[model samples]
Target: MRPDPHVDTVDHPHADDLHGDDPHGDDPRTGSAGHVRVDTAALGRVAAAVTAAAVQAGDAASAVPGLIPPPRWASAYSAERAAEAAGHRMRELSADLSGTSASISTTVLEYEDADARTSTRFRAAR
Candidate 1:
């Protein structure tokens, strides 16, 4: 069966320190440093774009005619999804990079490939 492009937003906890690190901590210009957790349930709206992108990527892979099957590099898909989640988190983060602009602390961006499996995590910096 073909994979579904529509990714379900699992019941993940809303976290400010998803990245477990903060960039704009104790900014004298920003007044104070803190974290803002979000309602994962509300993540539905934010997850839409990421889901679509994944579907597109998958479709693109299916179209490519290569010597071998397109690699099932699951991390690539997961990263795309997490990136979307990060975008959502960035918006919800309460930092004024500009008027109504959420300046989320840059989190740890890393990718690891495991034999037969792969994953990527985008932890939002505190």
Candidate 2:
């Protein structure tokens, strides 16, 4: 399947740092010196695209059994098994995509919440 054009698949410049052992090195809550900006709108778009793809994959999986004819001979039994396996894999892919979409949406919400809390804290401090 073709990748969604709306999703930014490019790796971030600080991608490595994000997974580094220094948990507080870039954490905003720790008064870190670095900043990481999140584009929540873009993330929402990505989540939507992933959800659509998951639906398509689920539909394809449902149709796989009908598309593959029943084995008429012993030689075709292997082919039938393979088709069943493919269908199973497609179902798994659909589930994974749905999970990924949910995770992305959750990330967007977390970022927005963090921004709002930070803004409130700054206002209270002033």
Q: Candidate 1: lDDT of 2?
A: 25
lDDT of each: 0.36, 0.74
Model 2, range 1-126, lDDT digits (tens) per residue? 233566543222244355675555565433332345455778899899999999999999998645456558986888777788999999999999999999999988877776777778879999
Residues 8-119, model 1: lDDT tens digits: 2122222333554555453243233532222333343434444455455545445534333335798766766666665555543312222221111111011012211221
Choose the strongest candidate by lDDT.
Answer: 2
Clashes of 2: 0
Reference-based TM-score, model 2:
0.70
Note each model's CA RMSD in angstroms. Answer: 21.1, 8.5
What TM-score does candidate 1 get on C-alpha atoms? 0.23
**Candidate 1 pairs with clashing backbones:** 18-123, 18-124, 19-123, 19-124, 21-126
What value does the lDDT take at residue 85 in candidate 2? 93
For residue 80, model 1's alpha carbon misses the true position, in angstroms, by 26
- Please give the RMSD of candidate 2 to the true structure: 8.5
Summing lDDT over every window of 10 consecutive residues in candidate 2, give the lowest-scoring window.
Answer: 7-16
Candidate achieving the largest TM-score: 2
